[model samples]
Target: MHRIFEFDDIIRAVLQHVESSATDLVNVAMTCSRLAGPALDILWSRQSSLARLIMCLPQDTWEGKVEGCCRDYIVRLSREPTPIEWEHLRANASRVRRLVSIDGFTDAPKLPRGPVLRRRTDGIGSALDLFRPILRPDVIGHVLKRLFEQFPPATLFPNLCELHFEAVFGLLERSSKFWLLRQFISPGLQALRFDITGIPTHEVEQLFAALPTEAHGLRQLSVSAGNGTAALTVPPSLGKLPKLIRLAIFAIDVSLTRQMITNIQQARCLQTLKLNLCGTSCDASGIPLELPSLKTLYLSEGSLSQCTHFLRQVTTRQLSRINISYRGSASPAEVTAFVESLSTSCQTFEHLERIYVVDKSDHPDYLLVIPLHSEIFRPLFKFKRLSSVKFIGIGNFELDDRFLKDVPIAWPSIQELKFISWKRRAFYSVTFTAMMSLAFRCRSLQTLHLTVDATQSTTIPRAPDGTEALWPTQTALRNLHLGYSRVSKVARVPYFLAEVFPTLWSFKFYERYLRNCAADIDLRLALEKAHSQLGALRNSPYENSDKLWENDSDDSGT
Candidate 1:
């Protein structure tokens, strides 16, 4: 004879199991058919604090397919309802707040009149004769216009701290009361990202003017322009925002940036600024180089000459972080000149090493009159305090002897380094083992990321030596991201844990480089296993949950 555990005891154990595992309950179910029912029940029956119930409103089934899933769940709950079921459905109101974001405009909810009417002859028991008349788009539009006309002292949605909208609503020549985008910023928003592509300039100006100072005084504002400079303008009212801090704008004309920064500087709280110029020219009026409080600044996809010139004007005394992307031919003299201009406070802050220049600028595009290995970075190695450096589009420059030898000189105080290239693709002549051995000598290296276009190699490289020590290390090296399999030697990730460096914290061992792909259960399990293995090193503990981001579309297609 056998005795069954109490239902409460079973639930407690299941909850504990779900909590401890850095994986999904669905993955746990897939491990064993016997565990499937209970594990799925745990995952589905439990409602997320922020989203809906997985069992009742299956995320996959939310897009108007199977019209009455919610009704079905109601039936199931009413029939065999357990204690957990009740807790999921009613206890969490946020989980049940259905979001029906419009593609081009806005609309409000209509009151429900019991079950949905299916028959044509369904009589005077209609939705029209409801407890109160439900407002339609036009009605709400008129009412909101009158309300805004009044200009009340306060608004609602106090809990609304962030508003990240991606300009899904196509623009019109004029603003409509129906387009109550302002209302969306319930409480004063702290963070806002606007995808203002294809919007007319006057409309942008109108909206900017209409927005109240306190309503969306966003501390962090990222504007991605699809059309061009027309989407961005430094509103006069922006200067009055109390807590505007971080600003990140992408795909806008660089000329518009100066006005935006001028407006930002008026706000005493502005700190971090990032400007992304994907395809536009950097001839924008010019960055306001004299920001008193600005500390961290990132300018990507601009000519390095422009960057170096811009930094020369700015006072880098308080600046801590600076990231510049390669866009033009910047010579070794130019890079070293900029480094030489850096305040001693910015450089030797941690007192590590001499400063240096690492220029892998390939061109006709200016073909190297001076070889990349010798003329460029070698002289700058004398001043080694500069720790960080980046190289792009250099597939042929594998960890060759000359290439490998340059690393020690370029990054003397280097603690963090990232290399994304096609290493295995072009390094056929260089033996993989020797290259690996050379890379292991960097004594001060810590976060290292090397991703190859593994699509270049058929399999891992098998050298005369048993295996390439891909992750060889003896220093405090931590955080390894070796993706796209460079060689056919190791069956799996090599020296990823303490064997490489003891203090390694974060590690990403991606099998395939697929972005926004449908998540597979096995792949998720493997990722969780790899993520959890960081505990073997002295790393931060990770929790078992998907990083749910609030994407622009209400539909979770991507």
Candidate 2:
């Protein structure tokens, strides 16, 4: 007789066996009552929208009479569903572990149909103006109040862990609706993200102040002041959250930078900090702040001097990742100074694994490139454990010869590398011999992203002894992203890549079709076929056959 697995074991098996989709889990819940409890728990755990939950309410609770597209949405607010049993509502709502609020741009469910409110197009430049205007401020407030009043917070969403508001402040700024919605706050909440763009500083402060003291338990908090140049003050209560592990602040002015730095200094457990300096000048008051526990840092859109000052003050030795982005001119000297400072002050850079030097300039014609000076990148080469590196923006440098050749030798453990250049013709004359040099040097490379000119002839390289050179192959490389300058010669890409990267499983080829070419069609079909074939081999039955069918044979040595 075979033994049957326990209910919990079966549930775990179902969830863990494969990547189950939302529909698959819902199907599991409908299978039987024994399996439904756990399946329902997983299904309603992290809801992206509250619209679905609101729709589940009784039909009579919907407000206003309607016609056309909004006819079926009319109902009055009620504690319980009119015809459906209250237990049904309790079953689903009780299992909800998160409620993610959507911004105006999201196509959420219509609340009560009213006048055909035209989208305000006069001064509607912000993303908030794009809302469908279905759930007006008053309607949302009323619904939330009734919902909270009907079911006490403890029973309604006892296991709630995250409450994310994505640019939902447009509706919130009109009134103190957050106060009405405060009852939904749970002690176990781990993450909170608010993109309050147009809201006033005082109102934003009030919203932050009203948060339950459980805010102290939050592990991650991301706040972005969408309005450009408007200083969004950080509430004093948020500064001392002992359990907070990750904090991100964006679009803050110079005056608030001191307070922000002070808060970061106080947060003892913050492991990751991302600050969008919002073009704020670095002042004397913001210096001397320290981050002892920080491991990852992202600084973007700030003056070079300001960024350098902040990095000089912060103290951390365990940092593994650093990303810096700039919208304006980020001269190579400025960037080098920042890195050199870290090399001298921050002891944690020795463990750094990832670094991104990105330039997000507005005008594509105006190029902002980082010149690769040996002295500047010398400290970067010291990152022996570095695995990922990205250099984005146009530069006055050759990517194929010097840059690629030195990178592999310097960072032998590199697994991923990306270079985004403005000159499309940079790779037009690259020879196959030069390309193989990178693979030979960086044996651990897995993901490579850069433009290449496969149109050039595959010239045979000779060794010092005048013998034909044998190119080394990299089996670890799985993902290759290439931007081709010409498509006619793209058909040769598959064969060339197969030789250089034997284990290539994913290939992304980007090309500009100036004029229709037959080879472009072949390239797409070839890549699709390769992807499907590799996918089959990766998920074949033989993958885990040995585990399930153990070797039971016992051979006696005669």
Per-prediction TM-score? 0.47, 0.71
RMSD of each: 14.6, 12.2
lDDT per residue, candidate 2, 324-380, as tens digits?
A: 766665566776777786675466556788877665555644433445443555677
lDDT tens digits, residues 1-558, model 1? 113333546645754556323244445444544444454333322111112221232223222112243321111111333444333333322212222222311111121212111111132222111122111111112322433343321232233444444332222222441244545553355555565555566766666655544455566666666532433556666656567667666643454555555565675666666665433444443323566666566665555555554554454334545655545555546555555445422433432232212223334232233212223434434435546544433222333346545666656567655443322122323333333433456777765545332212222334578774344455667555543324332322233344555555555644433344454344445455545655534456744321221011111110
Best TM-score among the predictions, by candidate number: 2
Model 2 is weakest, by summed lDDT over 10 consecutive residues, at 549-558
> 332, model 1: CA deviation in Å?
6.3
Off by over 4 Å in 1: 1-63, 66-156, 167-178, 197-203, 209-212, 227-231, 256-260, 278-288, 326-388, 394-413, 418-444, 447-475, 478-558
- Summing lDDT over every window of 10 consecutive residues in candidate 1, give the lowest-scoring window: 549-558
